[model samples]
Target: MKLDIQHETHYEYSAPLRYSTQSLRLTPQPSAHQTVLRWALQVPGKLFAQRDGYGNEAHTWTLARRLWRGAIHAAGLVETHASPWLVDAPALPSPLLYLRPTALTPFDRQLLNIGAQALDGAPAERNLLALARLVRERVAYRHGVTDVMTSAVDALDIGAGVCQDQAHVFIAACRARGVPARYVSGYFYAPDSPALASHAWADVCIDIPGRLWLSVDVTHGCVMDDRHVRLAVGPDYAACLPIRGVRHGGGEEAMRVSVQIRPAAP
Candidate 1:
C-alpha cells in the first residue's frame, strides 16, 4: 500500500518575533515495513536536513527575521510494504538503551506489579499485547485532560487521556516489567476520521524466541499496519515530537494542525 500524506501546521502570534526556529521530525525513517519514495518539507523559511540521534531524518527550520504568522508543511509519499507479523526488527544497537526511566515515563510500583501479574507466565510478545489491551480498556480516550507535562502515572490516575497518554502508560508499564519500550509518533490513515491522522503509539523490544520490536497501538489495542506511517521513535514523545520549536518575542501564541493521509492513485 502507498499513502500520500499532508501534515500542515500554522502558528499565529499576536506580535511579531525577532526569529523562530523549529526542528522537524516530519520525515519517516527507513524500516523493514516501509520505504520513503519521495518527501519534502514546506516552510516559511529555510530547511536543512539533519539526522537525529535515533537515526530518524529530521529537518531544521529557521525564520531568522521578524515573523508573526507562519506555516510549516510536510508533504510526502511513502509506500508501505508492511508485514502482519507482530515483530519489527530495526537495526538498533540494543533494546536495553530504551529502558531508562524518564520524567514522562517513570516506572511505578503499582504499574510494574500489574505488568508482572498480567504476564502470568505468558511470553513477552503475548504479555505486551495483553498489557496494551488492558491499558486501552483502563484509560478512556479523551482529549484536553492532559498535556505534555502529564506523566504516565498521572494519566493512569485520571483514567482518561489522548493517544500520547496511552502510549506513555503502555511504555511505562512495559518498562516497569523490564521490557524495553520506545515511543512512536506517526499518522494513522483513517479515511473516515481525520482526527486519527496524527497519532501516537508505543513499541516494545521483546526477546522470547528472538529479539524484535513490536509496534502496539494501546489506544486501539492492535498491532500497527500499513495505515500507520511512522515519523519518529525515541524513549518518549519529547524526543520524537513532530515539531519542537523555540520562539522569541511572541506573546500568547496559538497553534493549529491538519493532517491528511489518503491512498495514492495508481
Candidate 2:
C-alpha cells in the first residue's frame, strides 16, 4: 500500500521574532514494512538554518539567533533525507530480555509495580498485547485531555489520553520488562474513514530469531502495516518532534500544527 502525507506547522508570534533557528525531523524512514516515495517541508520564511540528518535522535540548541529586520517565509523545499534501512532488531540473550528482572529507570520502576498488579505471571508478549488492549479499552480516545507536555504517567493516572500518550505507556512497559522499545511518529491511514490523522506507535527490538525490530500499535492493538508510514524513532517525545525550532527575542509565541495525511487515489 502507498500513502501520501502532507504535514504543515505554523507559528505565529505576538510580536515579530528577533531571530529564529529550527531543527526538523519530519522525514520518513524506508524500512521492511514501508516505503517513502516523495516528501517535502515548506516554511514560508527566511532560510536561516536547519538540521537534516538520518536516524532516530533528538536536537539540542546551545545558541539562540536574533530576528532579521524583514519577515522570513521559506516554503516549497524538497528534502533529500530518506533511507532504506530495514527493521532488523538484533537478538538479545533471552535471559536478559525476559524471565528476569533488570535495573530500571525511575519511571520504569513505577511501571513494573503497575504490571505486577495488573498482569501477574503473564509472558512478555502476552503482557504487551493485553496492555495494548487495556489502553484502548480503558482510556477515552478524546482530544483536550493531553498536550505535547503531558507525560506518560500523567496520562495513565488520568485514564485518558491521545495516541502519543498510549504509545508512551506501551514503550515504558516494554522497556521496564527489559525489552528494547522506542517511540514511532508517523501517519496512519484508516480506509473508508472521514479524515486522516497523524499517528504514533511503539517498536520493540525483540532479539528473536530472524526478525529484529517489530513495530506495535498500542493505540489500535495490532502490528503496523502498509498503512503505517514511518517518520522518526527515538526513546521518547523529546527526540520525536517532527519539526523543532528556537527563536531569539521571544516576547510571546503561538505555535500551531495542522497535519493532513491522506491516501492516494487508486
Candidate 3:
C-alpha cells in the first residue's frame, strides 16, 4: 500500500520570538515494513540534517528571522509493505540498550508491579501483546485528559489518556519486565478516517532466537501493519518529538496540528 501524508503544525505567539531552534524528527524510516519514495520538511529557516543515535533522520531548523508565528509542515509519499510484527536484524547494537527508563516513561514500582504480574508466565512472542492489553485495560483511551508532559505512571493513575500515553505506558512496562522497549512516533492510515492520521506505538525488542522488534499498538489492540508508517524511535516522546524547540520570547503560545493520510492514487 502507498500513502500520501501531509502533516502541519502551527505555533502562534502573542509576541514575536527573538531566536529559536527546533529539532524535527519527521523523516520516515524505510524498513522491512515500509519504503520512502519521496519526503520533505518545510519550515521557516535553513535546516541542518543529521542522524540520531537511534538511526532516525533528524533535522535542526534555526530561525532566520523574527516571527510572531511559525509553522512546520512535512509532505511525503511512502510505499508500505505487509510486514509482520517482527523487525528483523534491527541496526541497534543490542536490545538491552533500551532498558533504561526516561522521565516520561519511568519503569517505577507501580509499572514494575504491573509488568511482573502480566509477564510472569508469558512467552516472548506474546509478551508485547500482554503488555499492550495491560495498557489499554488500565488506561482508557480518553484524549484531553493528558498532555505531552504526562508520564506513564501518571496516565495509569488518571486511568485516561491518548495514544502517546498508551505508548509510554507500554514502553515503561516492557522495560520493567526486562524486555528492551522504545517509543515510536509515526502516522497511521485509516482509509475511511483520513482525519485521524498522526499515531504512536510501542516497540519491544524480543531477544528470542531470531531477535525481532515487535510493534504493538496499544490503542488499536493489535500489532501494526502496512498502515503504520515509521517516523522516529526514542526512549520517549521527549527525544523524538515531531516539533520541539527553545525560544527566547513567546508569550501565550497556541499550537494547532493538522494531518491528512490517505492511500495514494494508482
Candidate 4:
C-alpha cells in the first residue's frame, strides 16, 4: 500500500512574543516496515533555522506579532513490504532496545505495578497483545474525549479514549513492568477503512536479545507496517515531535492544523 500525506500545525497569538526555541523529531525512519520516499516542511513566519545531517528541518520561531504557523506536507506514501516479525526483529539490522527506568515519577512507578499485576506470568509481548486486544474490545473509538496529557489509568478508568489514550495506557503498563517504552505519532494508511487518516501508537523494548524495540499499534490491534509513517519517537509524546516552540506573549493564542494524504493505487 502507498499514500500521500499532508500535516500542518499553526499558531495564532493574541500578542507578539519576544522569543522561543523548540526541538523537532518529525523525520521518518527507514525500518523493515516502510521507507521515506519524499518529505518536506514549510514555516510561514520569521524564524531562525538549523538542519541535521539527515535533513530533518529544525527551525526556531521568534518575534511573532499575532500569529505563526508551521506546516508539513508529504507524498508517495508506502506500506511495509512484508509483515513485521515480532519475535525475530533481530533479522532486521536496526532493532529497538527495551526501556529502563530513568527519573520515573511516582505515578509512573505505580502504573508499572498495575501493568505487572494485570499480566502476571506473561511476557511483555503477550501482555501487550492481550492488553491491546482488551482495550479495543472494551473501548469504543471516540474523539474530543482526551488529549496527549491524559494518562493510561485515566483512560482505562473512563473506559473511553482515542488512539493516543490507548498508546499511553500501553506505555504506562510497559514502564510499570521495567520495560522501556515510547510513543509514536504518524499517519495510518488504512487501505479500505475511512474513519481517520492520522494515527498514534506505542513501542516497547522486550527481553529479546538484539531485537528489543518492537512497535505495536494498540488502537489498530496490529504490529506497525509500511503504512505507518513515523513522525517522532520518544518515551512519550512530549519527547517526540517534528517541531515544538513557545513564544513569550501575554494574550491567548489560537492554533489551526491542516493535513492531507493521497494514497497510491493498491
Global lDDT of each model? 0.82, 0.58, 0.84, 0.60
Better model by TM-score: candidate 1 vs candidate 2: 1
Off by over 4 Å in 3: 85-93, 121-123, 192-195, 208-211
Provide TM-scores for the models.
0.92, 0.73, 0.92, 0.74
Q: Judged by lDDT relative to the true structure, which candidate is superior, 2 or 3?
A: 3
lDDT (Cα, 0-100) at 105 in candidate 2? 17
Ranking of all predicted structures according to TM-score, beginning with the best and ending with the worst:
1, 3, 4, 2
Q: Model 1, which residues run further than 4 Å from truth?
A: 84-93, 120-123, 208-211
Please provide, for model 3 over 1-266, each residue's C-alpha lDDT reduced to its tens digit, 9 standing for 90 to 100: 99999999998989888788999999997788888999999999998999888777899988846689988999999998867465545565466778898999986898988788667753365666776787888999986899999999999999999999999988898788787888889999987866547889988776544567778788887787888898998898888888888888777789999999888999
Per-candidate Cα RMSD to the true structure, in Å, reads: 2.2, 6.1, 2.1, 4.9
**Stretches of candidate 2 exceeding 4 Å from the true structure:** 44-54, 57-86, 89-110, 113-127, 191-196, 208-211
Question: How big is the positional error of residue 164 in model 4, measured in Å on the Cα after superposition?
Answer: 1.2
Q: Which ten residues in a row have the lowest lDDT in candidate 1?
A: 84-93
| Residue lDDT tens for model 1, 167-229 | 998888778877778898998888988888899998777563355777888877778888888
Residue 166 miss distance in model 4 (angstroms): 0.8
Best candidate per TM-score, number?
Answer: 1
Ranking the candidates on lDDT from highest down gives: 3, 1, 4, 2
Per-candidate clashes come to 0, 15, 0, 11
